[model samples]
Target chain A: MPYTDNTFFLYYNKSVLTETDVASLDGILSKCSAGKQFAYPMADGWYSSAFYFGKGLGFEVTYNDHLAETSIDCDFDNATGEAVTQAMWSYVKDSRFKADANDSKIAAGFNDGSIVAAVTGIWNRTTIQNYLGENFAAAKLPTYTLYKGTADEEQTQLVSFAGYKLMGVNNYSKNKTDAMDFAEFYCSRENQIKHFESRGFVPTDVEARADERVQADVCAKAITEQLKHSKTQKSVPSTLWIPLEGLGNAMITGAQSGSFDLKTQLKACVAAIEKTTN
Target chain B: MGKKRERIKPNVFKRLIFAFKDGSYATRLSFLVMGFGQIARGQLAKGFSYFLFQVLFALYMIFFGGRYVGHLFSGNLGSRLSGERWNESLQIFEKVSGDNSFLILLYGVVSLVLFCVFLTVWAMNVFGSYENDARLERGQELSTFRADLRSLINEKFYIPLLLPPFLGLLVFTVMPLIFMVLIAFTNYDYAHMPPGKLFDWVGFKNFQAMFSLADGAGFALVFLRVLVWTFVWAFFATFTNYFLGLVIAMLIHKKGIKLKALWRTLFVVAIAVPQFVTLLLMQKILDGDGILNKILSTNILWLADQRYFSLLPRTMIILVNIWIGVPYTLLMCSGILLNVPTDYYEAARIDGASAPQIFFKITLPYMMHITAPYLITQFVGNINNFNVIWLLTGGGPVDNVYYGGGSQAQSTDLLVTWLYRLTTDQNPKYNVASVIGIVIFVISAALSLITFNRASATKSEDAFQ
Candidate 1:
């Protein structure tokens, strides 16, 4: 049912960040200057989840027919999550790291030569490609050093959420046969290739993905590689985002200053995620 | 004797009883069958119209309204749980329909309102029949249907003039208001959405949650903080705009101020721009990496810094609101300033009063007395001002201490903005939003009433004149 990929990986300027430098967070940050920063929208819930999800923390939400969350079991406040939060705080405090990047901001920053690298999805492919030109490059999200300055420090690959845009025919459609035929035709390999050729949407069909054009795409290859470290976007509770965003915002703002207790903030975030109203 | 008798108007119940007791046979029959007296007295059009309404009410009650009213009175909104059923032909499960609670509540309220309207018409029918009997006793000829139509145009012209708007208010305003108020008492939230699930009335639970300081459900802390900020923001946003506007208008109006029209036009240009466009432009310009920062070569977060309890963003929003709000106030004050009589200034000058004394004794007091109502309205408007704060910061910089943990409130949020976030957030808690809405209404209403009553404009209207 999938039509294209809907997840984020690293988009770096090849001139600023070599392949070796793009392989690690420390390497990327070292190359980034105060003026030309590495953009990561950690204040956003979608992007912030990468840090916790990379450390094997996630949520299992149960939804009823009404699409209401009936129950949620989330482990984003566990010991490992606290360590991940600490590790994020280490680089988030760096002057070269920008934690508030949105799509337009990333494009503008790249166009103005203020951003050397950013973490975002394929939706910004055309704009970033236009801005960076021949220097446009993408790769799987880099490894982050967890629990730095201690014996437990380890280089772990950053995980991301992998989502898909799906084409579906409603069961109650008046012309079910026609709708099904249209859906099939719309998602066919050739049409998907055409779609990618024009709109830059990565096709979901296996044969379509194997096309020469798709294989040549750096974004497509990065997305394929990133999928190994990703979790399916399903089963994420609606309550998760706002609280995680709050947590992410807190990290970027108060983490370096030690104005907030990370453990307490994490506990509160988890509590809010599991909160239910009768 | 007749004049004295006419002066003593009988109450409705007394009139009804007296009509039934002292009326002729036709009037007595009309008590059982509406318009019977009117028809017997040869007012055919009016009588038939009343009879038509009776028949229509009966048909509506029997066919449509009876079911919804019954469901409303039953108190359980709906009982059927939507589920999947086996379909042998399709070889898959198909969704079975269930009672939709939302529609039940909607139609129930509509039926209740219509019943009230029907009762009003029934009272009119009885009263009309009684009047006819009284007219016949005086040996007066009954007015013809054509004469009645003529009266609607001549003496009762206001009826047709007001009817459409009255009906519109009842349907569009009153019905939806009651529906929203009722939602505050119910468990109608994301989890209890209708059609697929049922929401039961949980009276005062949402309100308790809002005010309760219990850990994990401590919205009270957030509410109190936002409430304080709302008041603070309103106080500053209103008065700052007022005084600054007065200053600007007075400066333009001062003697020897060359090219006054040019000054006025410049301010008017600010007003001509749509408010959202201006606010959005301000948002972009004041952003961390925006043009302002680029120009200043500084990395200061104009709208996103939460340090010192979000002093920066809060200050920036109020400052931006002044830019948006001052022009209107300036225009209003300009008109009022011209209206202030020249005699007061002449008298003050003759009395050797300084300019400051003259402004304080004459101009400022006069402006305050005349613009008291405007100030109160502006204050209440500022309290519920959602646009400037929302478009600028989206109530952001996300203060972790109070607004975190799914509070959905932020440092710079007004009650209206927080209420907005509650309803629009991914996990919408509509009941809480409605409760907040009711709170805003109560606050705005009480503040306006108390202030308007005490304002010198209301207290001594003739004193100024």
Candidate 2:
């Protein structure tokens, strides 16, 4: 975490929209969902955390996000949470938003040019790069509005979970001194730069960041901007994953069906989350 | 007539006692300290190896194993806490409490097993020394170490042959099964996850919670619903496949049925393509945005809508199960149906019986008589069927009973899937899962045992003969 950054950023085609248009959640959803290709893995529980956190449910979602989750203090039934869900109700019925949770499915959507933009992380960089080539660009996740018209427009930024891949030397290793030396060398600026050259890894070392290649990288700029809005993931219980996904997707489905009352359904989702966490 | 001889087998304890008393001093010494008699008989290599094993066992008991055996019932399941104290000498806080209950339990079981193996080795030493002394007393030449090695391949061949596979099964399968059964009595839920927290034996609390209607989670309530659906699913899955498959089999294998190979091959293609693929493809075809909706000119949330309390989803899983299951039964029924003799039908016709009467009285009974065990297995298979419900609907269209606010349990969920969810869900309930597993085992085992007994009982009737 001190060196590395891995968080979900908004990636879109330069051909479809401008920097100004992609700044807000409403703009992206309204413009893309109507006719043009836009998609996100809403059904995926991992991605669903973004919406809940964006809605300002329970507590402030922190950087140590996984460890931060104790029990469900869900407020999806409350005014603010309902307000966000109500905003989401508008986009839920759009054909552009597939009832799919799989990241691979999203990748396929991008590859086929059916999806003009998506919300994902650095792991998907290569796939999108190969698909969209020069047209591919990335930015921080779009902000959402809690108030309709109280002020002109005060936007609440969408936050995503951030994590890091780290290396450590084992205490019991026979080659402990050597292992420590290698670990240090592995994380060195020169080697980190080498990694960036070969594997396109954004380096953690400050010296490596000053490199011209990193300075020119498009994905790196987007991630750097996104880091401001990102939270460190805590080691939370796995129990919340499904219910979170379910709550988000259920709202999406409810929006489409219009049969299940949104508030009642949101209440049930909250109740399920509460019961599970308890 | 030769009488079947029944040898009076000596009780194990009595045999040990007899071996002790009748044995020479060296044999007695070897019982206490292994290979003493073998050393006396000049089988020095064998003697040394046996002695080495004894020393290792003694060392193990003294240093590591004895502690674990002692801790098993000591009522001190260590807390998963690292207590700290200020150390004046080092001028820093030092950790004190390092005891972990989970590791202790694991090590204890392993030690118990090792302790049993040591006892078995001790018994073998006593028996071997006793035999060696007996041979000496009878004035027979002592077997050389080479001769002992030769006898392992010839007379004791089965020991080497069976030991490897037996040990593999005992370690992997039997140990894990015993561990699960032990887990049923513990309170190892998400709240008490190890090695972060400690959980201890709570006796029958987990069992009581399963059946108690007063509990908060309504696990008992939903469990009953899931169990009922499991049985209903199993019954329909098995019988529909059986009857429909039989009809298909009878039709394809029926006399004067033309293009028989063509019809059979068409059905066999379902078998050739893996069921999981077929089921997933079916999912895509049946879903609202799927090909079926495209062709049918109707948008139906076939897998995701529960309008009538899961009447739709429940019916959907059963019907799909029958479709996937029938081809297997059809192939089997065709094979066995051929073996049903033509004589019963011929004789029934001679008695002026109606076509339906002959078909029911002869063909049906005969088929059931032969396929009863298969039917039982299929029935049990359906009870634990995870794939059909999972792939098709994922036990979805989330029902009301699942949540606290009077929601539905996903109507198509079999007990296995529900049990799977209980364990794999964010707040896993392992103890409850274990209890459910035991219950499922009891149900399936009981059914299989009954059907098997019945099958064997009627085997002597010679109805077909």
Candidate 3:
């Protein structure tokens, strides 16, 4: 019953990308998911994608709490608890994934077929293509509740939801019923399969995860493995991206300079985040 | 009377020109010539070499130097190579466009013009030398270049001599200052980027926003509060060093003080170390778990605590700055103190003046008179004390009440530090930064001008005698 799910796999390369590169890539991915609307929420690196998707295709999108825009005046008192519950259910129903952008690492994984599919959050798909080469297939994110026993079972566990792009019904929509219907249809198993074959994400439908294509994709396989352990970033009421980002910069600089105490630095960062959010 | 006036009519300019036309072979050739002027003036090798150098220089400028000069103006030049795009709204990349090519072209043209002016000056010098040689050949007095130099020194030529450098200062310093002052009038915030976003001249909008009590953003009220703190910080920073330096100088100069050289060197060591190095070291030492904090387990968030944070860090920096600055003043005061006549002190003591009385009446008055100019400069230096605030607290423990765009600033930040952070920090507001810089300059200039006028007007009548 999940509307949509998009899985982004993070690939680790021992020799290629440094931790800083991974961090930078994380930034680019957040920006991508900013304005996107999808059937299922994605993991990290979805912001930039959402931004492009929403701006390019005019999708009604909601992003993760960390990367959310400051202008979204949704308050807890007036918040649609029903919508949040539905979104949570839809997100939990999707499989999580991981992928490395290192070519040699991907080649090794693909050769052994250890990875069913690789997840990548970078804007430049060309980089992923160059890294993965011709040996791998792509697929859409799988359903979150595939192994679901209860809502509590899903809630107890956390997933790598650092980057996510979600779909929402826009208030100004002319065809509300038709739009909802279209959303449900697009996220169905059959349509998910089509989406998976074309877009490099796991199929969002609950049943579509069993598709042969989903089973065969290298990035998708790795993502499913990570989905079991993925945890979404905690959402604060207000957006603290810019300030928190500044704290991150200060932390990195402090670390580089070896000046301030790291613990104090972290505390300063946390304080900054709390101040901005509250 | 008519003949006498006619005889004196060939003034300096006419005499030189006439001498050039009737001069010896070398004089005539050098005076009338351009490229080979040096050789005609008896500088055969220098003339040939300079001509060749000019040819090569011209060629180099035409082919390569011109482009380099143009690039200084064109901030876009690097952007072309790097393709660095400012990600405006997450996905949408907006290329930074307002490069102000006119500024670059103007810089380039000015540089070329300066080079040409240098050439013309060189040509005139050659003509002057040629005229001098002609005068010598005609058995008239040869006023040598050395004589000219001596006469220049005698005439207090520093007035005219410093003109070129003064003009340069006016162009670069004064003009930019005026531009920055103008920026303070506009609302050039983050929403209004230049070139693509033409920020109209909003007369006194920014200043009003910073000063008014009922502004919508409430940022102006915060700025006004910070401004008071800034002035307090400047006053303490300036005077603390002054008094400390004077005391140290007096102590060392005392007859009973031993190993004066050794004591002075110990303090001088602090001065020898660069401010950046010392401030950076201080930043490390004062960290939460840093050496200073580690010594005391009461773990004060020196940079984080809002209650006492502003005053504490500002006071700490001033004290630390005294350690660095006192020695310089001490050295200066020592020289001035020695120059103070023993007769003044003896007369004061004979007249039954106490030690404090002598210091207050005799020493203080003399020091103030002699050091008025230095004190003004010191005040100016404190106003623009960028390194101290920057390397120490970095204006941190930012309060919500006074928050600007960033998290690294607080209410304690001096104008210079705030301006610096604006320009160099993330979300660089260059226009605002420049405006703050000008504000600092105006305050310093006004203070210095008043002090200068007072110092000159109130000089002792018998001091010059």
Candidate 4:
């Protein structure tokens, strides 16, 4: 379930973040500096939810396709959630990383060479590649250890929302036989291999992934590694998206501004979710 | 010269009474069935056409229109559930399509409009029939169909010309507005999106909640704060551009100003470029690591950053709005200034008055007099200004200083912009948004009424005109 045809992975400029540093979130965060750093859009709800989605919380989501209803269960204010989140939050006070809500700001930071590495999806692959040239490399998002700088040594890995582009035959098609034939032909292992070779799409067909060229491709290899840890995201109703974002954003903004303590902010976020769901 | 055309208009109720009393047998028949009077008076072609409409309308009502009116009262349940029945012989299930609520509502509204049109045509037929019978009784020659057609170009031009546009506006514009305004009194929020769920009227609950500060949500608190900023923004946006633009226009219009065309074009060039691009570019330029930040070596969160530590974004957006607005004001004020008489300025200047004195006495009074109406509209426009705040900062760097009520609106949000966020954001609180819409409409409407009344109050002072 990696539609972007591939998963988001760690894309780093080889000059700054080496293979060792790229393996862990804290390792990379500890090494970076002003005008040369890592940027993860943690203030964004979609991306920041990863902190809660680690093996500790095990967030669950369900959707009623018939009724267009969506239900999300995330206990991000729990002890594990706070620990993981606070670990991500530790980077914000550092001026070099420039953590904020706007995703473009991070992309721009990378474009201007102020960002040496970023946690981003495949949409930015070409841009990052062009920027880094031979220095371009991608890896599955690093396994993070909670509070790397402090005494707490709780280990966790980043989890992400992953999706697939599914194709189906219409029951009422005029040429049902022909349509079935074409659908099969399009998604066949041979064609999937061809797609991976040309379009860089990670094929759904298992046999297509066995191809030598696909195995050698850096982008595909990184994606394969990343997808193993991703959640098969439900088609969530858009109705929950903005409020959830606002809730998360309010928490971050409150904590940053000293308006609300972390515990109070966490309690309010859950309360908000409960209010909306009811 | 533009007097009301009372002579052409048929009196709403009196015309009906007079027509029935004076009408001939043919005229009375035409009232029941269109074109009958004209046919009985030897106009066979037009009479058959009128009768055809009567037949078609009757058939439509029987076959289709009746169902729409019926469904309007029916449960209006979106869709009957689709089902599949297993067929053992074929080893497959047969599928059935579900009902659609959208279609029912659409057809219901359309039919209602068509019925209204039918009534209008019925009235027209009665009026025409009575007029013809009256003319015949007066010993006046009855005009043929061709004469009736010719008169449309001469006297009855407004009927044919205005009818289509008026109907178009009613169907597209007025209907949507009425639909949205009605939604303000309903619980059509995220949980009650139509088709899947039914929403019933909740009366003034949405408005009540918005106006009340009792709820911990603080919707009223946010509303007042955003509203205050909206007015403050409008005041600053309007006057800054208006006065500064006037000064710039006067400087360029001055006698000693050289290369006048070049200076005007330089300012006009900003406006010629599309605004979204400029606002977006401005957003990037003012960002923390942006060029401006790099040059100044100061980490100013121009967009308030993630926290509202700085009121920089609010001030920046207003400043950019001023920059974007000045050119338009310059163009408009230049035209107004050109019409101001040189004699007034000369008279003030010859009286031993300095440059500042002449401007204060003669220039300011004349320009303000001509531009007062313009100022009101400009103020309204600023009140509704959505682009600058939206595109530049998106009413952001979220802060506890502003009221949220589950919205992401920041310190910079205008009421209109905040309403936009409420409606279009992921979990749309459409009812609250609609209430906000009505509030904005009331504000605009009240201001417009006051302006129009003031204008009429001084109508006799037409010396300026």
Candidate 5:
């Protein structure tokens, strides 16, 4: 087997990390995964799970691109009369989605299957679980390796992850065997448990992933289940421009504009993907 | 044989130099004779300045301006990766090389026209120089550079004649035209970008795709449909505004109408605000849950729904335009209306002519002639009326099947909106955008030319008389 380096490359969203968050994370890393170096690169994609881990794990964060901080105004929890009315109207009049009589949109009730389940950060775990109740389940992400995109055909052995830092070998290390041993020990079940309990991640070790206590944690469990269905957000250069959000916008606009040719547009989009990747 | 042929040649270059220096042509060709001779005759500094200018011009061509010229001609698109697709005759995939034959043909045609122009200019310079030299030899005083500059201001020749038009063309027409023309050949899109990844020439692919019944042909169809609607909208908007404005002006101008100034001011307010802001406010009012909808309690999805949106907005804009546009026409026609001879109307009444008959015989013909230029200008203006379509629906509540929308906005997108989308949207398809812009300009120019020519030609006919 190839000797793995103990260094984990962590990518985190810059928005979620404060100076205090970084300090607290450093303390956790010192108490838990000592002697292991973690590098957290700032990326927008890291807003999902990566931000949570980077803030909680005290990873060594670095970045090249600096995005101007944009404040997003969210009115999700307000539930004001006007808000409810607007939401209800949007649900009913979307024209794209048809609703049943008992649909939550019609009822103005707490929707269960509307979101089905959302994979959130460890901080929101309890809040969301309480909000969702028993309608959802949580499990472990099958692998620790993050990939660019799906291969032409699905292969079970190739479990995908997104922005998960892994311990890798330093090809030019003087003490190769020692580094290998350290990496193995760092990622072992015992160490991973220490890391997970302090930081908030499903342990990379198979045994630790199955632990009862870890499974009981709502956020951790949901992320674990999400991991099973996880396909890496495409890492093609074109994906940089066509973010998941941008694609969603395109879909909405396509439906709205009635005149735009989506199929050819999508094909041209794929060709763009191929060009950028090469 | 070459030596014998050289004896017959007059050595035009040497002769020109001699003619410039000592010959009778010096005064006539004063403008062209200034630089090089001054250096040779010990005015080194001035001669050096001219030499420096020549060098700068050469450098500009080599490094910067030439690329635009090259882009116009061929763009060297044949060398791109897409151009390397296997030719059936060659039966092998290779980098496509050599000049584009079709582009070469175009260059030949444009070059022939430019050559004629060059010859005319050269002849004028030589003739003028010779005339000046002959006059100088006869002791006639030479016109100085100061005199030439003064003449530009004083003569009221082409400068006074062409300044307003030249400035308008430079700002509104030429600058934009240049930008658009450059876009047609370059692959300025989401994939092929500049600065990050340079975009090169793509030849006539954009035009070919637009015209052909290929995958991209659907865009052409949407463009055509939108173009048809655009023309229809222009016609309706112009006539509606014109007639309504004329009627309102006449009514207000009548002796019986009270608060003439107040009524004029009230209508003028609609025209006062910028069209973009007004249209945006109007869009909000007409939205599904907007003020109008809320009051009406009818789910007449004016903007949100696709089916009704296409047809309704055209009529709605014409109506809205009448409200906003009629006042300008009213203001203009007011002055003209007052200028109509009251004696003619009195004479008509004396001759047993009815009010309608007098209006048809005297008022209508007089108004059309006096305001023919304004009417032509307004028609052309409506053809390019971008703000109304842009703000009202944002050429949307958007669709994907529309060529202009490209899965972003829909078929309701006007050529201008689509051009905006192409130039400013996520994927800047500047090449296609430019093509559309030029096409729009051509259409507008053709319409304006016909109207302008007709107005000038028929001015003597006295349509009303």
Candidate 6:
């Protein structure tokens, strides 16, 4: 049974960013001052995937019964991925952009008014709401410019990885019938609404989502809007994260401006992800 | 007298021959049946205890330990791999039981260690029986069970006192060490976990993978970089703390300095707080957007910038470590500095020695002679220092150009942290981690042995006195 949408969107200060400014990465970066920065955790694997995935680049992985990766097919090192890498580098090179944002940093930044906007998930909705008070606002991820200053430049909406929480009964459970009944009861629409009311978990059930409280939540609406531009996070190899984190760290550290070859780095990263041992 | 006793001490084979050739009838019988001679001589308590031990060993071998010992010689850890079988009646697949390689290895090691212990006890029983025969031939009065128990409390008190700790060391330290060392020779990794899968003995393949650059394993490259950084960090961490601590201690001990107790108490307060807490606080303060940067009104990435190959973060880590480390040395050096005899300074002053000359010739030499071992220990501890680096940087500001893709090592990682990452990673390579463990042990052992042998403290222990 589905529980809620698990994805990220943009959280901003409405006093600093207008609705039009929140729609594009350029507008947001331009509006952000040195004192009040825009935070995006590009050095993290989970957040860094947005740029590549937004351009339709992804990985397909296969594993044996032992959960060992048998093979992986990935196109994240191709030309499309290079263009996405360039787009990420463009923002990271800006002084107004903070690339090392984490849970604590985001909270501290919002509380001290050092960060005007940040890209994070719904898990932080309550803390951010308390910090921003009436100035709190949310929207789907802004459009990023690709191949800027070139003839083939384009603006595309940043895609995010969406995940779903599910309740399942173990196949070897001693009381399978009871377990199944319990799992179903836990995911029922009324229970889901109760869960949302208590913990701020967005409901997966359509009828439960139509509840007055959920309908008015800016974070829930933003999540729903972001889901339209999201890809399902399934079958991603465990090897993908470390290498991708390295690449993201490199991009944010200005490795792109040097003689460093992005294509070779991406190629090595893909090869590492696909590597298998006997 | 000692030389004569040493000459009389027979080898095991000679003693066994002598026991058999010149033994009484009961002693000869005791060769095949343990404690027979003692039983015939009416040492009921000793004889029965030996007999009981033999019975327990035989039962353990027959029931519990024999199969694991057999499997140890089977080459592969286990023969069968676990899988699932179809159950047509229930329309489901059932899990099939198979040999667990991990259990096989663990039980095998335990059985081997127990066998060694049993052999030692068996040797004691044989020798004890022979001693009983000798006492009878000499027409000496034998100690009864009560006297034997009394003697254990008196003459053998040290044996009872040492036995429990010895057994504990064997079980906890020695057994786990052997298990980890043996894991280096096997393919025990995340993919080959037991029950669902079985790992085989790969024999030295992990070592080769770590040392060979031709295979593109990339471990050799990472090893060299981490090893070099480890030594470099240790040297700087040790010496910086030592010299600065010595200077602070001298300043406090100087005649003109007032509020000496207050200064010492302040430094002691630094030490009172838990080390990890101080390190974590330093981490937050040194962050790119932390309080330090805000105070300076500059956006310098004090600990996160990886440009120029993470020079900023690495240097900041050593600086933060100095903050946490210097106070400990300060406390130690203060005590040692006080103990430096006033007579040496008086003699040096009479000889018209300059301030720098007295310090270099008399003070520095005395300090070094006493603290040589402490310095070496501090050096080795710094090499394995995981807390400061882990808390401050997490071995990060990860430079992909140097570490490459798929490498868990970061630019700031010590070998210990890298080994930790290898074991905790998603695709954990236990064999590789074991190999790194062995390397760290060898390096620490060699360095400590070489330095300790040459150190003035060990070489001339009586010189100062």
Q: Native contacts retained by model 6, as a fraction? A: 0.32
Descending-lDDT candidate ranking: 1, 6, 2, 4, 3, 5
Q: Name every residue pair that clashes in candidate 1.
A: none
Q: lDDT per residue, candidate 6, B1-465, as tens digits?
A: 011124567888787777777777877887777778778889998888888888898899999999988877777789898778887875556677688999999999999999989887877777777777667667787778899888889998888889999999999999999989999999999889887689888878888777867567546887788889999999999999999999999889898999999998887687788999998998888876689988998667677776676888889988888888889889999999999989989998999999999889888889998888889888988889989888988887666557753556788999899889889887798888899899999989988886777673467654853
Question: What is the per-residue lDDT of model 3 for residues B1-465, given as tens digits with 9 covering 90 to 100?
Answer: 011124454565675566466545565565434436446545555566556666676787787568746664443322221124655454333344544333443444455555665565555655665644645556677554466567778886986789789779867875555455645654444444443343434566455444555424325555655567777767787788777888888888988989999987887788687878988988777764367775885334454344433555566777778877888888888888888889988998799999998898888888877887777777777777777877777765454334542223465677777777666654455556655666677788898888879777977734631
Which segments of model 5 are wrong by more than 4 Å?
Answer: A1-278, B1-52, B55-132, B136-176, B215-218, B272-274, B351-362, B399-409, B458-463
For candidate 4 chain B, the 10 contiguous residues with the lowest summed lDDT are B399-408
Fraction of native Cα contacts reproduced by each candidate:
0.37, 0.08, 0.00, 0.08, 0.00, 0.32
What's the lDDT for all of these models? 0.84, 0.72, 0.52, 0.71, 0.50, 0.83
Q: Who wins the TM-score comparison? A: 1
TM-score value, chain A, candidate 2 = 0.81
How many backbone overlaps does candidate 1 show?
Answer: 0
Candidate 2 reference-contact recovery: 0.08
* Per-residue C-alpha lDDT of model 1 across residues B1-465, encoded as one tens digit per residue: 011236677897787777777777877887767777789888888888878888888898899888878977777888898878887875555678788778888887898899888877766777787777667667787789999889999999999999999999999999998888888988887778767778877778888888887776658888888999999999999999999999999999999999999998898788788999999999999987789998998767788877777888999998998888889889999999999989989988999999899888889989998888788888998999989999999986776566654567888899999989889876688888999999999999999887867773467654863
In angstroms, the error of model 2 at B279 is 5.0
Alpha carbon lDDT of residue A150, candidate 6? 96
What CAPRI class is candidate 2?
incorrect
Off by over 4 Å in 1: A62-67, A70-73, A170-173, A255-264, B1-32, B82-96, B405-407, B451-465
lDDT string, candidate 4, A2-118, tens digits: 223534667888878788888887778767887677777655666766666665464445656434345555576778767765665555555555565355665676677878878
DockQ, structure candidate 3: 0.03
Task: Identify the superior model by lDDT, candidate 5 or candidate 6.
Answer: 6
* Model 2 chain A worst lDDT window (10 residues): A59-68
Query: Least lDDT summed over 10 consecutive residues: which range in candidate 1 chain B?
Result: B1-10
> Which stretches in model 6 have alpha-carbon errors above 4 Å?
A167-184, A210-217, A255-278, B1-32, B79-97, B451-465
For B165-209, candidate 2 gives per-residue lDDT tens digits of 988987888767777887787777766666556677788987876
TM-score of 3: 0.49
TM-score of chain A for the candidates in order shown = 0.94, 0.81, 0.48, 0.79, 0.39, 0.91
lDDT of each residue in B1-465, candidate 4, tens digit only: 122325776676777775676577888787777888878887666667777877888899889887866866564434464566775765545455555444555566677777887878777777777766767667688787788778888899998899899999979987677667767876777666654455545778787777877556446776777788889889998999999999999999999889998998898899887888999999889876679988988765677544443366677877998889999999988898888887777777778899898888777877777777788888988899999989987876554333444444556788888888878776677878889899999999998888887676655422542
Question: lDDT, candidate 4, residue B302?
Answer: 70
